[model samples]
Target: MHDRFARSEWFRNDRFGLFMHWGAYAVPARGEWVRSYEHIGTDDYQQYVDAFRPDSFDADAWADAAARAGMKYAVLTAKHHDGFCLFDSELTDYSTMHNGFGVDVVAEFLRAFRARGIRVGLYYSLVDWHHPDFPVAGDPYHPDRDKPTAEGIDGHEPDFDRYLDYLHGQVRELCTNYGDLDLLWFDFSYGDLKGEAWRATELVRMVRELQPNVLIDNRLEGSGGEKGSIITAHPSEYAGDFASPEQVIPVRGLADETGEPIPWEACITLNNHWGYHAFDHDWKPAKLVVRTLVECVSKGGNLLLNVGPDARGRFPEKAVEILREVGDWLADNGESVYGAGAAELPKPEWGRYTERDGTIYAHVLEERVGPVALDEIDQESIASVRLVRDGAALGMAKAWMAEGNPGLALVPIGPDEAFSYPLPDPVDTVLAITRRSAPEG
Candidate 1:
């Protein structure tokens, strides 16, 4: 473990990451919540464990796919809420080492991804349904919630404190046994169990000691607990490096209590589910995927696009195809996105803006009326404008002047003039505008 670890420049500059949701749940070809949604008890759920043999699971292939898609980092589920461990943990018998796989998936993930120069993160669910010490009957997402299993029927009592010790021990193993990890993403916290209830302070201290730069997420809180505002140094009793907003991107990037900006990442699925769902063919198109990445960067946030590997431990063909197309788009227009953040200007009606060093990438996602209106910027300040992909300098002029308007780029409304300045295709085609050196006040 590298004690000098912390969220470094790599995370902030990369702006995009890959999230993988895999476990025994993928064996069912259902979503990650297969057990809880179906209310299947431990005995019935063990069928997946018995059948779990991912002969086609190639960590290198997975890493290559991520690198192709221009993902700089990736996070894999080391253990899900179902409590199946992908790693060979000495403390747990129910791990990939003993389960049918008989392989350390986490080790493979680290070795393969690192080979491609991609940083790795591990996702560990705090709520373990399989652990006997975990309150199976009381926890809402537990498979045996409100129902008695063999242990409950035999008059066994659940000791949550013991579970905490096990959880902390497993975390220690993750931090120590493996090499430096970029992130230790905890799944969630909810209800009264939020925050300090998990003895997060002690756990965080231990993690920092093990790997000083390991970035922890907000979910260390109990189920349904708050992931607090990133504006504050310590959102709760525990301090984390960033905010994790799942499913939906924030309307605007988060701001702290005092109105300072907060670093955040939007974790979204490529389709309807996070884990393999055989019938979840309702996938998002590559166009939308690329735009979403640009959108996150535009809002001063990161996008963690997810991929749910199938039962054979390979990405579905559809997902692979989508990623390939996205890779192509990124290859051409990556300059506008990588290392860029919110331009701090008003949201453009046409699309969005991402700022980096001395340039602004104007992403046109929608068709806005007439010449591009750079809402608040002065027309005189733009030194040059070039189509991001084609590399052609576009001519500009002060087309209209209004009460509060300094000026907007002028373009002819006629058909023939359209040929002079053509729009970039693929929806999120970006225009790289170089700002002139600002005049001294």
Candidate 2:
């Protein structure tokens, strides 16, 4: 069923997503850090802009990599401050279409992603430094502060209404042109003028009317808003269709150590830097990436890992290589992740478990020496127990029926081979174990 803006299945089942933070600003190679690094000076940053040319930018290639990585959706920055648009916008001359890149970035990405069966989401920042109608202390050519230039209805030389018209036109273009967008994630919502709420509401409403099932993020709300809220009010007052926890996944799963409701996602970058910084070679090992995903899903959260491409729009060689390694792991063990619920394992000196379809997938976090003990769960419910990693079958070594601690033990077959073998690295080792008769009441 549908939950307001997003499908419940999409919210729960999609355990992985790819987040792309790309814009004209990435041209500097120092990353989007140029916004603060150059200290809001347009003329100074323009040097990097003029030299920005992505000759090898290929949307299809990026989309293909994402698909191979097992990402269900990809979110791209439609426009990040510095006022440059990735899509063809009627509002500004500083866009990919007008720039040397002379291509509709969003349109091309949408086509590539859709062809690869990946859903598309756009990230649009609320602040625009280029617009003259945008309130500022200095010349309209550039705002001194990086914050959005508030709209002043009565006191601006350039028509403020025209700016809103431009915003609306571009938003309409985004929703309609993208063919059924999945998300319009807005950023920087704490500051918007009085009517901004209405404007945002109308914009999102218009988008929903067009797509009928599009989802909008909460930043569109004035101070307490989500996209469905009345014009620019903050959507916090309303429960968003889904909670988007950024940067960090809860240390434990969705619930804190004390069990509570918290749907979240961990948006971590492959390296220390988000955008490709030529000097930043540090990449999170595939093992770390896999472990992070396990921790997230164990807590009822999705892992929306981010990978910043170079200005040429190609996945950095480091990122691509690591992704392929992770993909191989996922290809072999995806069933334990996709369409699964937060793990509920008994106090195990050895492993953690993820459950789906009346089966408990034991992800061996630790390998015990002699025997594996499973307590509390009814033994009659366990149809067959096996070790999945190396195709070794586990035979029932012992079982005891006690009212308090009903127990079963599984022993490794070919103990000579198993004993000598090393356990899977720090990464969680997933072992698929089917239940006997589906846990009887």
Candidate 3:
């Protein structure tokens, strides 16, 4: 049941998924953390709720864009730290249904993604800024945390256990209503709010009962600072199914104390903001996006790349275009990226390498003006080598025994002069190396 037990093979094989950060905060177009960042009191923030109108939301387009980008699964922010539920929650009045959207957005997300044969996941936040029973006292993430609840215009005495009922009730609704969920990505638990505070054991048990096969994340470790580690407190019972790293990829594939690699996913954003912001234009290009995906595979991890749809519930055109280009790259070079894991070989100076079925995929990233060295790759083990970009084979003339190295192979570009390209391909060219023969004894 725990992480040490087993993992879904599909998760290991898929390796790429989409993360959508959308909610009522998107209406502000500031960012997902606008509530805390701006420190606006509850009454002021109600303006967004009153004005929430996303008439242009097209679920099919979102799912199609993700599928086209070679993403096998998607996770949406069913409810963010703001406590705005995108689904129709009967337990609470503060939801998309009350916003007059007259629709259950989560249901829409499920229908579209499921129709395209993509797995579904839901993101729920443990911190609720809008929930009354949830305390604002001493809560760093809360805008009114510093101020006394008695002084706030929209303030009330908070009860800890009452909030738990609401939290558990909402979670049960998500698990029971969603036909089949692949993942439940919880936002996090910070100081003073750890495992027992949320009654995680009972909550997780409920989730398992609802969807036996769905995988859970390790944020339940209650160690908010420990992002890349999913070690459960207990051994036999399952807590979270996987480790989740936010914003950046791990230096090395995340490993346990014993150096055994732990299953993890790098949840990164396409731009500076996770939610739609009309002003934040620091969008990462498509080339960087594809390269990041390859880097994840090489590091033996998955990439949960993010996209923030505007308040209209539509993905920005730039994000769509970037994902389309990434899809094109995956269409051609997926053999080197999908279903691949960390290679036994060390990282080449030129680029990274990923392995699949004993075959090596050398991702040539930089321009090799002279020669590329395969440091420890024995030449005899190479059955054949060809460029994935254009199935052109490379022979012994191109690769041969290195002069000084014992078992290395040097891929020479020219006899006396180096061959250069006017411009390197925007995307990395993968060199697929197949086994020629068994390694010599």
Note the Cα lDDT for every prediction shown: 0.80, 0.65, 0.81
Measured on C-alpha atoms, candidate 2 has an lDDT of 0.65
Error of 3 at 426 (Å): 3.6
TM-scores for all predictions: 0.92, 0.82, 0.93
User: Model 3: runs farther than 4 Å from truth?
Assistant: 1-5, 150-155, 222-229, 232-238, 398-401, 412-424, 437-441
lDDT (10s digit) by residue, model 3, range 1-441: 234536566787889999999988888899999989988777888889777779898899999999999999999999998888899998987888887877789999999999999999999998888888887766777877666553322656788799899999999999998788998988688787877778888888999999888888878654333743354343324347677878777888776666666677888889998988989888899889888888888988899999999988889989999999999988888888778999988888888899999889988778776556665687766678776766777654333335566556655433432454421354787878887756579
Model 3's TM-score against the true structure: 0.93
Model 1 bad stretches (over 4 Å): 1-8, 148-154, 222-225, 368-370, 398-406, 411-422
Query: Can you write out model 1's per-residue Cα lDDT over 113-216, one digit (the tens) per residue?
Result: 99999989999988787888887655677777757453452356888898999999999999999999998898778766667778988988999899987777
The total of clashing pairs for model 1 equals: 12
lDDT of 3 at 400: 30
Task: Give the per-residue lDDT of model 2 (tens digit) for 149-252.
Answer: 33331234556566677777777888777788876766545444433543755665677678666555555543222223322223333333454555566655
